[model samples]
Target: MQPLADRLRPRTLDEVAGQQHLIGASGVLRKIVESGVIPNMVFYGPPGIGKTTVANIISQVTSRRLYRLNGTTASIGDVKAIVDELDTFLTPDGALLYLDEIQYFNKKQQQTLLSHMENGKLTLIASTTENPYFYIYPAVLSRLTVFEFKPLKKEDVESVVLRAFDTLRGESGESFVLEQGVAGYLAAACAGDVRKAVGAAELAWLTCPPEDGQRRITLAACEAVAQRSSMRYDRDGDSHFDLLSALHKSIRGSDPDAAVHYLARLLLADDLPSVCRRLLAIASEDVGLAWPQAVSIVKSCVDSALQLGMPEARLPLTEAALLLATAPKSNSALMAIERAIADIQAGRIGDVPDHLKDGHYAGAEKLGHAVGYRYPHDFEHHYTPQQYLPDELKGAHYYDYGPNKFEQANKNYWDEIKKKHR
Candidate 1:
């Protein structure tokens, strides 16, 4: 018997659960299919969304025989066999080739399809759970129109779950009634994955015991099958980077709630090192010199986290996140370094001023190293103004004081000392 997910596979665009943006009455894809000229395209998004279903529908609408291949196992030979069929009387005009998880295909394998796509021997619809721009070679990527399939909404999942339950009930030849809210519960628990929701509904129906001569599918049964809400995270994929980016941005934006929320999500995936590394970077890159001690404090938190390990590690990490969110924010240090690098890259580098050059070496005096240098400790307030930057960068300011208490205080002290020197 086929899995419920496979049994429920949508055979037409109208049967697909979501992706109204692509298959709705006015959707771009719908218009393309109606025009009877389906071009090569790539579907990019998470799984259990309707990429394959839509591709299948496009093949049917365009009256082309569909050939499905999984990139994980399909070899160059498999593709060639399909190409061989193009010359057959049965597939005279051409055929649609559906490649799933296309990212798994190596560059050479991906390239092999280019000639076929260009010659119209194959109309390609490739799908990936990754960003194609990063995985697909430009030669192949440039040939396909890319469409992004978003996760199904809760209501859409609920509708699909109810439909699956009805199908299961009829197929089993048993009387079963879904408890109120069972579909909605499964929908929310599945986290916008229509296939998962359908599977859960099928499981709930099978595991449910008959009461009063009819089986009752309850929310509890659905919960047991669904378990924890599905989380779309791959440590090596965009989900990993996307969550890390969210956590960092939340901290940088000064929202402790959002910061901790994303942190918990990453930690739940057991990605301790990534979360720790990102937090440490946030301390210096985002908090920066505004609270110079932030680096040290975050470092200690990270060290303790590494030693304590997960669950417990979350404690110190949480503290670190809260502290960073509450701390004064600054990017002046980050911007300062960036500006300096830009100058160097643009050939603005000048010879080191003689007074700032290394003078401890023998023969340095002959080269005028450290000449005319003023020792600040020999003056009042340990302060003296002298040329420190390269001669070409004289009077150039790379760092402007960030509008924070600690920075402003340091800025005031330096300003006063320079005023006294003047």
Candidate 2:
């Protein structure tokens, strides 16, 4: 049996669901189709947003001989064979070559397409979930325009549900009445993914028992089959933004347990890279100089993830999250830099004192550069109050050390130095 997604696959641009930004009137794609001019391009986005479907539609609309290949399995020889076949079918006429998961193609395999794209022999339309700018070859990327397809919206998912339910009804002869909440429940579970929504609807049908040979699909029935409570976390909506906000706040609030909990949820849902990146920001933004080690630890987790990948790599992330949550919290460093930026933008610029200016440049000595600069090592405690900040910020204090052992000791040491210098 054909999968629900496959059965309802869009045969034309009109039937295609979602990605109104790309297919709407006056959209780049719509314009291209209308003008009968298709360019070599890359569709960079997440899974199941119609990259393949769009490619197929373009071929049909343009009446071009389309050759589709999976980048993961196709070899250089296979690509060459297709190119040879394409040559015979053309006399200055163009063809569309669709490559799925283009990132799976290593640099050597990618090089095979550079000449073809450059010479305008084929209109290459490639799709990749990974960032093509990082994964694709520079030469190949340079020859293609990149279009980003955003995840489908909830409304789009709902539209798909309505269509699927209608189709099911037609086939089953009203055997099932799709309850009002059933459509909403399935749509939410799909998470801005039309494919998943269709799959959930099919599951609901299979699980519901026939009433007089007519099955009635309800919210509970869908939930039982899908094994998901609700689709409240719309990947492309406000809930998505809200989850990230809560995750950041949970860390900043200094609850290690809560931090770990949120981190676990995100990781379990496969948002590790984003979690790692956000932790890096939190280290400097929330922990700052209060615990300088936090930044390095977060960075280490990121590197570790890149090295070990998933499942095994989650340990480093867990360690980093716990360290950040327990670390002394302060926004002093974040604030201080922001204040400095404001000063600069407000044109409160001050001249560099002669002693602090670079002495390695020509005629620096005559210019009084490095004139009165004192070596802190020459003094006891390796401390000196020689001016470092500009005059406007000379006595301004930024970091107020927290109650942590290391910060306390450093604070005492700096306090004694300030007294001696005064």
Candidate 3:
């Protein structure tokens, strides 16, 4: 009942498609296996990116005894049973206990491993999709070196997909025809998850009835299968955050093409609300003052989107995204507000000048509130120098406007006014 991904799992270290950083010849694992003394470690990363495969490869190459457990289901009793079994073996490096989703282990179950790990009964290889610091117990973490497994690259996924077909042909003597670029399409669509890529390919394979005694898979077939999988828009998952991030960064970096690409991805995810919110923030925080009108444009786009919904709404959104991507970018306003906030948080406080205090209240005249106020309308150019900040930050400079043509006039006006004060 093993899936195609598991069945086609790489057997040797050299066979792993990606993860060259950790499993290459000069990798830490290689050094450990070469030394014949494997230690406890944790492999942290997203799923289907070869955590279990890497662990299996390490155990085989190092000739260490291997025991596998799932954190969600494994218990203290299971740990005891495995340790008890391994206790009878006189292996020098002890057995390797591979626990998937190690974050699911409760403190009590994890506690059972403390003595076993310390005594060399098991060299633990724990894996988790969540952050290890937040999920793994400090005691268990202290004994394991953490290694991160990145999602496999597009080429890696393609290689895995192609290899599966190779195995199918070798076993059945039937050639599976992969339409040109179908492998790449599946690879890219899986978001670097090799296992997901294989599953998609498998679905496409199963859906295709053989023509002339050979199966042919195309992008359309893979997409048809992907419709029922995670390729659908996940509004609250990692991909949601990733697409929003990509869109923001692309606009900030002045890449209209990339910004539009990420926008399309968000639309594919069907997360219109999140897209609108992120666009609004980007217009203000990123495109602030540079293209002050960007705020209105993006807001109009969002308003139209909410009113009309998708497909039709994508037009205005695209226009706003393109406008932001091509606009000169700055964050001076955001930085200025944050700096002011920090000053307040650091206990910066000052009494308002009598002239600036609330003088509209009863007895305000006796308190000298507004007594010495200098009306700016009475001064030349209807402008007068005044201290608006708290006493401690009277002349603090926060805004650093970039080379934006739209803000140049504002910056020049300040430059002349500040000169008068100087």
Q: Where is model 2 more than 4 Å wrong at Cα? A: 90-92, 228-264, 270-281, 290-422
Count of backbone clashes for each model? 0, 2, 1
lDDT of 2 by residue, 1-422 (tens): 79988989998888888877888876888788778878888898767778888888887766667788898898988788767765664624756789999988989888887777777777789998777888888899988889888878778888898888778778777656777788877777666677788888887887787888788888887887666433434454444555677778988998888888777767766676678788899999998877787788789888998689788778998888888888888887777778778878888768787798899988999989989999889988887778887786677564566666666788898898789878
Q: After superposition, which runs of candidate 1 have C-alpha atoms over 4 Å from their true positions? A: 87-90, 179-181
Comparing 2 with 3 on lDDT, the higher-scoring candidate is: 3
Q: After superposition, how far is residue 114 of candidate 3 from its true place, in Å?
A: 5.8
What alpha-carbon RMSD in Å does predicted model 1 have with respect to the real structure? 2.0
Can you rank all candidates by lDDT, best first? 1, 3, 2
Q: Model 2, residue 337: what's the lDDT?
A: 78
* The candidate that achieves the highest lDDT relative to the unseen native structure: 1
Give candidate 1's whole-model lDDT: 0.90
Q: Using alpha carbons, what is the TM-score of model 3?
A: 0.84
lDDT of 1 at 139: 97
Candidate 3 wrongly placed segments (more than 4 Å): 61-65, 75-95, 103-122, 131-143, 173-181, 209-220, 227-237, 417-422
Candidate 2, overall lDDT?
A: 0.79
Q: State the RMSD for candidate 3.
A: 3.5
